[model samples]
Target: MTTLPASAHWQPALGGDGFVEGIDDIRQAIAIILRTPVGSDPLRPDFGSRVWQYLDWPIDRARPHVVRETVEAIRRWEPRVKVTRVVVALDAEAALKITAYFRLASSGPEISAEVRPK
Candidate 1:
């Protein structure tokens, strides 16, 4: 496998290059997209989800809105995967927990990823 420069975050795999591929790559992309605030990237003003907006909102309202936005953004940006479900939860410390279920575009295998905005 070719070693690729880390795009959003550094993730080292055992006995493998730092390159992200297949399902893992999709997961990483989702994490980066979710964490990035909209308009943060001047080149792509709509490249990110709106999860950051709900960060300070009440949990009851924020949870559903965040989940909807997460699903919409992933579907729009990440065409390599078909999003099946999105779950939003708040931990005791008020941290957002986002879990997304999806299937690869080329293959039908189901996969899940968790994304928490930094």
Candidate 2:
């Protein structure tokens, strides 16, 4: 694992309708990650990761706005990182899932996160 330099602030470009909701969720997720304990037997590193993991695809499919919001939120939260991949499927069901890898400069190692629609 690598450690990235702390960001000065989050910066994201979001579409109009889903912007607020997405930003809020991203903020919440970041807070959760910040609060995670770093130890030998620590809990999940971040609540955002858990939230993403258990997100309901159907709901996101039904409401595409939510997925847009999430993407924007992530972009803003971590502007320095670049998205390595993205997957969107509408045929399976009313749901959306996004998995991303990122590279950061000025750090010990690269950091990445998978953001899923909830």
Candidate 3:
């Protein structure tokens, strides 16, 4: 996986959607990732009850397939245009970096990319 520079960022343009569209996309991506033979296993080592309870509602309601499709679409778009690496800041102090690599096929215009979190 390529290493993203610490300063990279991804800001989606979804005006006034209040994250609804973003969440939907995330759901599709998750679904596709989960369905892939190599990445399909669900995350384990469950969090403690308190933490789990805090996230239970959203986790229970998430649509995996939708998330998967959304991610697939993004990956497909990667090389067609250009995408910056994503950098996420946590706790107002630390940052998580991610990078994507692309591959193209002659038969199709679509590009495939894999984003790896670092």
Candidate 4:
């Protein structure tokens, strides 16, 4: 069977200093975008999602904003994937539970990325 070229591309792993490839990289990328507060990166002030601003609001109120930010941020940062849906819910601990569903631009199966500020 032919190996998927997606496996060749990779990104630096979160925390602990390692690298991640394939879907893991994509997942990490989304997590990074959501976790980073805007303007935190001096070189790329607009590189992250604005969802953090709405994290304090009630889930019902924040859902749309969170979805918008998630979609926009992924569209801007990760051109390889086209986000199809974003799900925002409240965690048991009263934290945000965001999940973005997307399909690879190259025409593959849909995938999802769970995002949190941790």
- Model 2 gets an lDDT of 0.40
RMSD of each: 4.7, 13.9, 15.6, 4.1
Residue 52 lDDT (model 1): 92
Q: List where candidate 3 sits over 4 angstroms from the true fold.
A: 1-70, 76-93, 107-118
- Candidate 1, residues 91-110, lDDT tens digits: the string is 67778889999998777867
Best by TM-score: 4
lDDT of 2 by residue, 23-107 (tens): 3433434333322322322553322222343245465453454444444545554554444444444335644544444454233
What's the residue-level lDDT of 55 in candidate 3?
22
Consecutive 10-residue window with the lowest summed lDDT within model 1 = 6-15
User: What is the overall TM-score of model 3 with all chains considered together?
Assistant: 0.19
Predictions in order: lDDT: 0.82, 0.40, 0.30, 0.85
- Which 10 consecutive residues of model 3 have the lowest summed lDDT? 46-55
TM-score on alpha carbons, each prediction: 0.81, 0.31, 0.19, 0.88
What is the descending lDDT order? 4, 1, 2, 3
- lDDT measured at residue 85 in model 1 versus the true structure, 0 to 100: 89
Task: Name model 2 segments beyond 4 Å from true.
Answer: 1-67, 88-98, 105-112, 115-118
Worst 10 residues of 2 by lDDT: 32-41
lDDT of 4 by residue, 1-118 (tens): 5333457678767675557898898898889888888888999988887888997887788899989988999999998899999888877887789989999999898899987765
C-alpha lDDT (0 to 100) for residue 114 of candidate 3 = 34
Instruction: Please write out the lDDT profile of model 3 over residues 1-118, one tens digit for every residue.
Output: 5343333322232334222222233333423332244323455322111111112234324334323333443445322332222221222323221222222322333333332222
